[model samples]
Target: MHGPPDARSLNRRAAIKVGVALAGGIPRLGALSTDAPLQEPARLKARPGDPTLKAFAGRQQINTDGAQALAWVPESVKRDVASPLVLFLHGALRRPEIYLEQHISMADETGTIVLAPFSTIGTWDAIRGAFGRDIGVIDASLRWVFERWRIDPRRIVISGFSDGGSYGLSVGVANGDFFTRIVAWSPGFMIPVKTIGKPPVLISHGTEDQILPIDRTSRQIVPALRAAGYTVDYREFKGPHAIQKPILEEMIRELAGRR
Candidate 1:
């Protein structure tokens, strides 16, 4: 007689089932055409029942392997006014949905348009560049959002946590012309750039983050930005490698006020 399945075995089976279901529904964009420039969505139509007027409702096929999509919390609170856009990247665990949920309250309060893009791969690599078709996919997605929405280009902000945080620094600092503000939490050092366009950056690190040392950030990343003439706000928190709700709220408020 077969005994009951163990918890770990049951979980593995469930994970496999979920993966298979997702794979069947979404086509992989890997090994697809790289010659064509990614296209942006033509219009920004109001999505119904979007609490924040921002819905993560668009899908794009970057290549043949698979497509990545994002949900947006559009600036619905102040219908008459156009608000700044905030693009948030998720950590290596690849939980974009969770990230959006965590920040939904803040986004709604500030009338900020939140864009959280899903990485097809587990982690995003800004140093070596996005693998397979991710580069095209990401570029297309960003352009689509900017063009589709009546966004204030000068007020764009990019933020992330953990691995995503490192990406925020890499992308935000390199493309400073595109984004005005950046928030990086529990980030590792991104590949150094010879010159970075100046932008306001808030780097928050936890003292007990063993995964990515706080000292490395204080010693290397912060100094590099300062030396590059970028305005940096570095904060050290007394915690582990997790985002503190209070600090995150304050940062969001400060950024929203600037716009």
Candidate 2:
């Protein structure tokens, strides 16, 4: 069986290499070297195909190892059609179900599917220090969804709010080819491992955000991303550390093909 390696085999090899590197070089202590940053451990392995679960509308709980994960499928969606999907991360000390409930309306309005996965602990592993257990949780949740639904690859997005927003930006940068779009709401900072495909970014920050000040966060991030040749759509509003309803709706409209 001497032939070109399949996508799954290549991805598996990459994962193994990442595992060895993390085990030998990158310590769980979360030390990032200036010359070499830690690569993101999680990778999207599943693709659109025949489903295992019956496609339906509304929320579905897909918890993993006691961690809460949820998906919101739009009403009247069909299994034969590929639907847009969003991988949403939650803020620090937040729950995925609450976050999904707050933003699931956007998915319903635009016929997009929303998947929100909880961090193993208080916050995302990367934000705490280095990428760890949460990576496996996210990847597992995604594989489950991919095995149960037809997702639109072109419309797959990574988005979040506050701490989740920061983590989403970081992960989206590392896996931009898979996540076609990146949306951050009142993000604080980014801990990017490596830049992958160039995906357009949409960031909305509150000018008066006290939790994660706008000046030190998105203000600095947007410029760096632009300098690195990323097309960023940055917006500033007069509010606190929260998602602006109108602004978010507009962004979702653009993503949902309504605009």
Candidate 3:
């Protein structure tokens, strides 16, 4: 009987399977422009023996609406002289604090400034026409952090988990020029791309996820992205909808290297 598969072995098998599926078929990776510069901001440069990792920690709330306040990770701690900023969007449940807590360790390891803006209302989608305002608030908040911290715009990375992951993809695809990298963990929303951007994407989904079917994302979404000619790094864990520690570690490493 076969023992449990190692992480590297599983990843290799997945990559080969994905590669073979695209071979002898209409080229889907042709839509992206690989000539774009990969240089990130100087702030993202890895520092040796930097104690800023332990010194960075703070929170603040922005009044997006008159009465409603949007909680976010403000630029309070001045650790690194220059550091890349990362905007994290929460899931549909709209709990920014929870999301931040979950990913805080990753941020420390990568030395990235994380900003998670909470929705005033429970959900980001207020109504049919309200998405614009909701997204605008998020954009404004990001700009606020950028201007306040003087962060490198090119090094900005956006990511989310589950419902947040879906929103992150939507936001990144819609405004791909603003971010250098996009990561979606168990993303639910998958949209078609008309004009592909240069930002590389890392999509992680669980094969055993019942909330969001793996086939839909791995088969349909991945194919659509490939057809659009986008460089997508897809990984599927043999678990459920939760974000595991090992996966988070890999994500941090990937984002750090991108910068």
As a whole number from 0 to 100, the lDDT of residue 254 in candidate 3 is 67
Ranking according to lDDT, highest score first: 2, 1, 3
Model 1 alpha-carbon drift over 4 Å, by segment: 1-67, 74-80, 127-132, 194-196
**Model 3 local distance difference test score:** 0.56
lDDT of 2: 0.71
Q: Return the candidate ranking by TM-score, descending.
A: 2, 1, 3
Q: Best candidate per TM-score, number?
A: 2
Model 3 per-residue lDDT tens digits across residues 1-259: 1111221123445445434543443232233233434431101222122332222245556554332323333344354455666677765546677666666666666666677876556445521112444565575565545444545556777787765676576557656766788888776554322333657888887787655556754545566666666688888778866566676677666665554
Candidate 2 regions with alpha-carbon error over 4 angstroms? 1-39, 65-67
Candidate 2 vs 3: which has more TM-score: 2
Candidate 1 displacement at residue 92 in angstroms: 0.6
Q: Supply the global lDDT for candidate 1.
A: 0.58
Each model's lDDT comes to 0.58, 0.71, 0.56
- Backbone clash count, each prediction separately: 16, 0, 5
